[model samples]
Target: MNSPEQVPQDDDAEVVEPARPRRKGIYALPNAVTLAALFAGFYAIVMAMNGRFEHAAVAVFCAMVLDSLDGRVARMTNTQSAFGEQMDSLSDMVSFGAAPALIVYEWALKGQGKWGLIPAFVYCACAALRLARFNTNIGVVDKRYFQGLPSPAAAALVTGFIWVMDDAGFKNVSTMPGMPWVAAAVALYAGLTMVTNVPFYSFKDVSFKKTVPFIVIVAIALLIALINLHVPGMLFGLFCVYGVSGYVVYFMRKAKGKPVSVIATSTDEPDERGLH
Candidate 1:
C-alpha cells in the first residue's frame, strides 16, 4: 500500500456534484392566460373555417381582450419574464395577425382572387414586421406612445369591421358589388398602418394605482351602458375613430413643427437610424 499522505486516489472514482433542482416551471398564471388568448385565436380561425364569421369575429375580439390582460396581469403579479413576453408576441401574431387576415379573406376577400389575397397578405406581413420592430426597439421607444398601431388594436379594427358588417347582414359579402373592395380597403388600412411611424397613444402612463374623481367612475358606467346599447356598431365605430387618430396626431405634430417620431432622441447612442 502507498504511504497514507501520498496515497494516490483511485483515478476512476468520480466526484458527483449534486444536481441543481430544476427551476420550477415558469410562473403559470400569466402564461396560462396567454394560452387562453392563443386558444381564442385558434378558435377564431376554426370558426372562420366553419363559415361562422360572426363567431370568428367575436373570438378574435376575445383574443384581443385577453392579450391586453396578459401583460398587465404579469406586471401586477410580479411574474414578468422573457418567456412570457415571447409567448405574448407569438399569441398576438396568431390572434391579431394571422386570424384577422384569414377571417377577412374568408368573409370577403375569398372571391377576389389575387386582389383580395394581396391585401390580406400585406396586412399579415406588416403585422409581423411591426411586432418584430417593436420587440427590437422596445428599449428606445416612447412608453407613452406606440411607434405604430398596436397589434391588438389592429386586430380589433379588422375584426370589428367584420362583426359590425356581419351583424348588419353583410355575411359573405364577397359577391356584393364594391364590398370586396371595401373589405380590401379596411384590411389595407389596418395592415399598412401597423408599419408606419405614426405614434399612437399607448395609454401606459394612465396609472390605475392613482385615485380618480367620482366623475371618472360615473363616466365609465355611462360608457359601459353605451357599449351595451349597441355592442357591434359602437365598438366598431370607436375603433374606427382610433384607427385614424394616429394620422390626426401625426399631421398635427407635423404642422406644429414638432418631432413626429416616437423614438427617443439620444446622441450618446445615435445609431437608431430609419426608425422615423
Candidate 2:
C-alpha cells in the first residue's frame, strides 16, 4: 500500500489539451462603417416613401461617402476580407442601386405610371449587373479606367436631376404632362451607360504626392469648397456633364481613330474627386 502523500493522483488519467483560440468578432470599425452605409440606404428608402425626397437623396449620398470610406479603412487597417467585399457589394446594391432608383421613381416617376416604373427597374437592374461585373473583373481589367459607367454615377445623375429641379422650384416638373417621357429617356440613357463598353477614367493612377505648386493646391481647395457649398446643383451638373461627356469623348476618339474611354467608368481608377 502506498502512503497517502505518495498516492497516485488522477493526473495520470487526465490529459491536458491546448486552449482553443477565441473566435474573432465581425463588428470591426470598417465593417461598422459599411453597416452604417447600409442603414443609410434603408433610411433613404423610408424617407423617399415619406415624401422627403431631398432627405432621401442626401441619405443616398451619405451612403456613398460611407461606402467609399469602408474600403479605404479596411485597406488602411489591413483587415480586407472576402466577407467585407461581399458586404460592400450588397450595401452598394441597396444604397446606390435600389435606393436611388426608388427615390427617383417616387419623387418624379410615379406620375408616369408604367413608363416611369420601367426605367426605374431598368436602372436598378443595370446597377446590379454593373456591380456583379465589377467584382468579377476588378482584378482583370486595366487599372486606369472602368469598363462602363459606374452605378453610383448613374444614380447621381438621376438624383441630381431631382435636386436641381427642386432647387429650381420646379415642384410640378414630374407631373408636367410631357415630362415623364423625358425622365424615361434620361433613365434609359443612364441604364444603358452601365452596360456599355465605354471606357471611363478611373483616376486611379493620379497621385497627389507629386510635387506641385502651392497655387495649384489653393485652386483645388477653392474648387472643392465651391462644390461643397453648391453640392446639389454642382453634383447634378457634374454627373450630367459626365453622362453627356461620354458621347463627346467617344465621338472624339472615333474621329481620331483611337479607342474612346469614359471617365470614372471602372474601378481601375482611384477615387480622386470623392465621386467613388
Candidate 3:
C-alpha cells in the first residue's frame, strides 16, 4: 500500500478563534440628564428639610423638566438601552414619587399625625404601583393615553399646590386652619386617581418634528405669555385642571357608551388578560 499522503500543516499559521463581539458600553448623555434629575429630587428633599419650601418646589419642577427630556434625548440620539430605561424609572420614583410626597408632607402634613401620614404614604404607594403597572402594561395600553395620571403630572399637581400657596405668602400656612386638610385632599385625589382605570392624555401624538398650523403656534405663544404673567398661579391652575380631566373624560366616555379603559382591546396580548 502506498504510504498515506501526510497533509503538511504550516506550524507558522496561527489558529484564529472567532473575533469576539465588542461589549456595548452604557450611553452617558441621557443617564447624565437622569442623574441631574435625581439630584434635583434630592435637593428638593434637602430644601424642604431646611424650610426652603419655595426652593424645594422649584427643584421638583426642575426635576420634572429634566425627567421629560432624558427619554426624548435617548430616542433622538439612538442611545436607548435597558440600562437607560431602568435608570429613568428609578429617577422618576425619586423626582416624581418620593420627593413630592416627602416635600408635601413636610410642608403641610407634619402636624396631623397619622392623618397626615396616610395621604403621603398613599401617594407614594400609588406611584410605585402606577410605575410597575406602566412598565408591565406598556405594550398592552393605548399609546395615546396613559392608563392613569403620569407620576410627573401627579407630582406636579401636588407640588404645584405648594408652590402657588408658598408664592402667595402661604409658606407658613401649614398652620392655617383647614390648610393641611386641603393638602391631604389634593394628595389623596392625586394618589387615588393614579391607581384608577381612568385614562390621561399622554400627548405622545404631538410631534415636535411635524409642522403645525400657524394658529397653533400663535396659540402656544399666547399661552406662554399668559403663563408668564403669573407663573405659579397659571401653572398650578393648568395642572389642577389636568388632574381632574382624566375623570372628566372617563365620565364622558361612560355616558357615551364608549370604552373608558386605556388598556387596548387587543386579543393578541394574552398577558394583559387579568391586568387592569
Best-performing candidate as measured by TM-score:
3
Backbone clashes per model, in order?
A: 0, 14, 0
For residues 1-276, could you state the per-residue lDDT of candidate 2 as single tens digits? 865676555855877799996555454878899999999999999998888878887888788789879988997887777778899999999998998889878877898768778989999999999999998877556656677888778878877777777677766567787666776777778888988877676666777669988999899898799899888998888788877765666677789787553334455553323222
Off by over 4 Å in 1: 1-25, 267-276
| Model 3: per-residue Cα lDDT at residue 82 | 88
Among all windows of 10 consecutive residues in model 2, the one with the lowest summed lDDT is 267-276
The digit string of per-residue lDDT tens for model 1 on 131-193 reads 999999988877778888998889889889999989988765988889888889999999999
In model 1, pairs of residues that clash are: none
Give the lowest summed-lDDT range of ten residues in model 1: 267-276
Predicted candidate 3 versus true structure: per-residue lDDT over 64-180, tens digit per residue:
999999999999998888888889999999888999999889999998888889999999999999899998998888777888899999999999999988888886666888999
- Candidate achieving higher TM-score, 1 or 2: 1
Better of 2 and 3 by lDDT: 3
Off by over 4 Å in 2: 1-27, 260-276
Compared with the true structure, the alpha-carbon lDDT of candidate 2 equals 0.79
> What lDDT score belongs to each candidate, Candidate 1 first?
0.89, 0.79, 0.88
Candidate 1 achieves a global lDDT of: 0.89
Runs with alpha carbons beyond 4 Å of true place in candidate 3 = 1-24, 267-276
lDDT of 3 at 48: 91
State the lDDT at 204 in candidate 2. Answer: 69
